[model samples]
Target: MKERFLRAGAAVLTAAALGAGLSACAPLVIGGGAMVGTLMAIDRRTAGTQVEDEGIELRAASRIRETLGDRAHINVTSYNRQVLLTGEVATAEDGQKAEQIVRGVENVLSVVNDLGIMPPSSLTQRSNDTFITGKVRASLVDAKDLTASAFKVVTERNVVYLMGRVTQREAKRSAEIARGVNGVRKVVRAFEVISEEELQRQLAQPAPVTQDPAAASAPARR
Candidate 1:
């Protein structure tokens, strides 16, 4: 069991390394697909569901901007069709409004509104949050028994929010890893918990193959 998670994490280390180094950059991809295709391939969500999550984030963000404008500082992160709203709003009313907008988005199963009532966080503070996020991500990658790709880490005001489809063991283990990171004030989990049996079944499924660019460019056999 430990060996399986280690192997999976090792498979994506190169891509993850680049992502960690450029933690502040726009998301990096591997194998011409979103978010390091290898990671996505190993993700608990089906490829189609993963795509839907991205759509949910985009649509919800757009709607929030149209409705709230600069009145709030909101970050929308969707995993497994569930939306997590973090950051601050000018007022409690704005926070409630933001949640409603997200819930209205197509295919959003639920919303976890953690929006604070305050002015937008400063650039320096936001930068620190980004740094904290990267540190938490690195901590997860270093955990041998956990498949780092299976989790999504988000930070706001030094609080780390973790989202994923995982077994209870994974949920507990990952939260421990996140809390251990420096500058992480709190760890909030929004995991879709599954049984150990379901996890084993998922692990037994074949992982997607990543083709070598050189081989991909070569002509097919007759």
Candidate 2:
């Protein structure tokens, strides 16, 4: 029964994500740190880097919010410790301050400041940003040589920010794919570029699988 249930759940997710170019991990039903563990199994970054990136995001966000208060609207996305800041701010000084604040975060390696000098974005624009991000991510999934799970896609004001550790070929291909998405105004590569050889080495090593206890002891679903 457990095997059948898991198989059915996987099938439903596969169907739902088809044509959307999302990671198979996106719709996973696993819980807690287990969810992070499962996704990390297929992620390109080392587990340490993933943990650091998460830390950088949280630290940067907290600092940004505390320092800027309600005067500015900022979005921070950290991948492999490289942060990307987007959205709107009241002044150029505020934008610079936001980036500086993120830079002070311990694990942050670098930052890309794309915040505009304007009032905060409306709900409609933010919603559209979400839609565009999904579309770009889906497009990356459709790309033949690109691995959707290997990259992080963030969209703000129609600009698509791509982050990950990828080879030059993969990064360029990913940018091209993102640019082709309907609502993407531009594609910005914030990747930690690697060699093709390194990419292949990681690809050849299969992800470690942790058996679901209930399913493992059960009969096969087929």
Candidate 3:
């Protein structure tokens, strides 16, 4: 069990490191070295689902802009089709409108609104939040027993929001990892938890023959 987790963790780091360094410049191929596109084979979501999430985010953002204009400063993050709405709006009504618009998007499983009903965050605050998010992500990558790619970290106002499809152990472990990172005031889990056995079944499944370049490039596009 330990060996399996370690192998998975190593794969996560390798893909992430190579992707950051070379994805802009080259592609990684496997199994007889055939050109198979970018190193986009590490995510838990399906290719179609990823594309759908992208569409959902874009449409929701557009709708918010059309409806509220500059009255709201919003961040839309979708994982496994679940939309997480953060940032601030000028009024409670605007916040509600933001969620309503996103919920209307196709393929959105649910909407988690953490939108503040106050003034928008300043650019300095947003920059600090981005830095905190990077710290948490790096801590997850340093964790030896968890698949960091299985988790998505988002931060707002010093709070860390975790999103993903994960097993119970992974959920608990990941939250702890995020908490240990400095400047993360609180950890909020928006994960879809699964059983350990289900995770093992997924790990044992064979890779699909066809690689969707669109799916492969999802992270890059983000």
C-alpha RMSD of each candidate structure in angstroms: 4.6, 7.1, 7.9
Backbone-clash count (model 3) = 0
lDDT of 3 at 14: 48
lDDT of 3 at 186: 95
The clash count for each model shown is 0, 0, 0
The models' CA-based lDDT, in order, is 0.81, 0.74, 0.74
Total clashes for model 1: 0
Candidate that scores best on lDDT: 1
Off by over 4 Å in 1: 1-36, 208-222
The list of candidate 2 runs beyond 4 A from truth reads 1-34, 206-222
* Lowest-sum lDDT 10-residue window in model 2: 19-28
Candidate 1 per-residue lDDT, tens place, 50-160, comes to 879988988998899899998888888999999999989999999999999999999999999999999888766777777777677777777878877788888889999
> How high is the lDDT of residue 102 in model 3?
89
lDDT of 2: 0.74
Q: Which residue pairs show collisions in model 1? A: none
List, residue by residue over 99-191, the lDDT tens digit for candidate 3. 888888888889999998888777667667766776776677678887766777778888999999898889999999888888889999999
